[model samples]
Target: MKQDQKPSVVLITGGSSGIGKSIGTFLAAKGFTVYGTSRNPSKFENFEPFPLLQLDVADTYSIEAAVAIIEKQHGRLDILINNAGAGIMGAVEEVPNDEILKNFTTNYFGPIEVTKAVLPLMRKQKQGLIINITSIAGYMGLPYRGIYSASKAALEITTEAWRMELKPFNIEMTNVAPGDFATNIAAGRYHAPVRKGSPYATSYQNILSLIDNHVDDGNDPQEMAKAVYKIIQTKKPKIHYKVGQFMQKFSIVLKRILPDKVYERLLMNHYKIK
Candidate 1:
């Protein structure tokens, strides 16, 4: 951000609200040129700080068109924030296959496709950064959130491989896994119905309430925005970064050091599952 230098251009997918919106506003305030994307841009007509572009990560043509517009306007794209995602909650035994696939389409494949669309621009620029917003849940399989966990975990691992491949090009890639944030993710997340007399009905209902409350009391989205800003300023960013509350972030470390069954017991106990 020197006097002679142009502000870096950043594109954040799913930018209309929640964490994406916060990040865009934060970066814009810091003098970075920011553009946020939504599946339907017209709905966010009054969005401030940065303009919203119409981009559905799940649609290849939409992804390409959005990137094309940015390239035309800015001439160079410096950062891509893969933040668009959806959540799914259900028992592995009960969640429909199509629902699982749909979740993956939004949370896993969507980000990957968007990254693919942006890579050529980054490569041509010979310098760029791609930050994939993963989740702390991705580190382990939570009972009702298995699909959501798997989708994020997939992105986390994929980013590791992508980082190595992009090394020679001076382009960088990384994953930032966030824990529960006070976002509207719960409202948007797909939930398999708690069928009457189903074996998991009681426990599933209990955990569902727990999950919503956790999100309701989660950290501010600005915390994530600051973390992203820090990563962008890093000369050689790490393959992975995590942002969340103390115990939430520590949960990953516990999983690494604790016995498998012991960790499972701890998780079940916290969820009040038998």
Candidate 2:
């Protein structure tokens, strides 16, 4: 963690695809000892792969075991990227309560659980960076993305508390807030609130149509990975890094500048949702 010494052991969660995979590919190419985790790494094929550790961030036991393996092999961890998350889309009222809780557990609590397991070592070493892959949802509200927004919003709060607490120990917390990224999020999402007789059923179809368009315009994961690497090497990494289209930055700025009603209307108008 010293200015002259660099930490080479990097461990990333959800490194099988999208942003996580891109970060792994980029960092490994830069000579970092990359240890990426996948719930099902077998899905990766024909690609230059990083040394993988089996971890499902949603499972604390899996996270612990992966960290143990990393510690035993590498002796120290220089970076921790909390990139494991799921896209759960639906209105809060329509989504099954259990599904909402489960999504929150995976998207919000999972990162904290993994971080808790790794922090003792990071603090003891007094020099490590923790990067969280949050979304623009953390800053702006959107229709039908209630669960996803709430989850990232929770992390945004956690990051703030953690930033102050960890900085004193020479560890830093950086949140990556990306906008529409070219990923299979919408395509890969699992909906637990699909009920034909449910009142929100018709609205759900409309939401899905909107999401299809959003996914069509997402950013490349590699671009996000490169940004993360820069954050790692930079001397002063901020508390948050925003990626994606200019709208991503514009949204954040508007959130800061606009009144509550104005922002809410803008959000509704942006998605053409009531």
Candidate 3:
């Protein structure tokens, strides 16, 4: 390796657009060998300056292949950001079993599988950082976006466990809990089996409007990317970091101290359900 060369390599999933793309681009500009992934890479090749790998986080074979490509090409992976995830919005009872499974497959299990695939390389290197992009909702379940919250919450718990377990290997893990950002994430939200005359229709519609407005007026994806860049540079990064609007990020702390009913009312008020 050259004396002044950028030797670090980073692999980010779901990096075709939005938050993932922003992080990949930001890190690449800083001289890291960044590889962004999507289920389809050629579609985004012209749009992005850096390399984009074809990866479907939900598929085991695709994940294994993507990691193999990165390891074979770079010979080392310094960072792995599990930023591939999607949201699902539907009443708990109304959401079909398969729909819930699909949501978890993408949001929860995908990261786990990707991390498992990359651990060997990081382990061989004996030092690496794995940052999972959970959500502010992971700390507290949202009104209509319950499954999204649940999946993120599951990821959060798993991250904590992995962090402790990976310490001996010098493999670090962190959870980045982001609030609604100005991205195309809403377009990918799964609103499955939502019936017109369902009892939760009014609440769902109202909550959806609130969610849209929040995201429309939210922070940029670059903000998240910058925060993550700092995390990458930190020598002792914290186990969890929250990024988003002030209130959204603060809500996590509030949930811990506030009474259950009080917190419930605050959530209802925020969603304008009452």
Candidate 4:
């Protein structure tokens, strides 16, 4: 590489911490010019090897402004990682409309808008990679976290369509469906307001405990970051890359081979939902 040649520029949303932060720092250390986004940059104290830009994926203005900042400084973006997302926990029927909307806005719409904002630049370059950080939940809707699961599933489908649609322009797109990973997600996960006498109240609590435990015992964020680094280096990445524990990664495969009832039963048993 020529010394005068600039490093590839990468923009990862919701990157102040957890998976996003790890990915940003890892790629930066590998010589890419990485920028991670947070809702409030002032709140982030550490982002070694990269810088933080203020961005709220839910807001169009914030998304546009952040992209502009990158364009001004970097001139072109080589990669866009849509890792910013939020979750809402509740039974599908019990979750409020607002809560479901909130989940979709952050986990689905946010990434869609971010991709739209970055596409023009990518198209002009005639080459770029868009990696949407979805989840294993996207493949199968969990008991209480239906909204989150649905939102990710939606993003995954959009990415599939984008991959084909953008092929002419040489824009590559894929979904990284990670199973549970040890991160600050558990600390920030949102739950629905459960009424004392509501039938779902007790069940919700029990199920949440199980999910929390699973997350606590999940894979390392840095491990996931390393996976993303490899995906970036590859000449042509797959449509979907599932990363997690052996069973979690295999779950996606089982879902394909087993009958619907069989898969759901397995999922319910694993989550202790029944």
Q: What are the runs in model 1 whose C-alpha is more than 4 Å off?
A: 1-4
Stretches of model 2 off by over 4 angstroms after superposition? 1-7, 45-47, 192-194
**RMSD in angstroms between candidate 4 and the native structure over all alpha carbons:** 2.0
Q: Where does candidate 3 stray beyond 4 Å?
A: 1-5
Ordered by TM-score, highest first, the candidates read 1, 3, 4, 2
Instruction: Encode model 3's per-residue lDDT on 105-199: one tens digit a residue.
Output: 99999999999999999899888999999999899888888888999999999998889999999888999999989999888888855578899
Candidate 2: residue 168 lDDT (0-100): 85
In model 2, the Cα lDDT at residue 173 comes to 86
Residue-level lDDT tens digits of model 4 in 174-248: 889888888889888888777798888887888888888988898899988999988888888899998899988
Q: Over all chains combined, what TM-score does candidate 4 have? A: 0.95
Candidate order, lDDT descending = 1, 3, 4, 2
lDDT per model vs. reference: 0.93, 0.83, 0.88, 0.88
Model 3 residue 266 CA deviation in Å: 1.1
Top candidate by lDDT: 1
Candidate 1 weakest ten by summed lDDT = 1-10
Candidate achieving the largest TM-score: 1
Model 2 agreement with the true structure over 1-92: per-residue lDDT tens digits: 22335448889998877788889989889878898888877766554668777888778889999999988886788889999888888777
Weakest lDDT window of 10 consecutive positions for candidate 4: 1-10
lDDT for residue 1 in candidate 2, whole number 0-100: 29
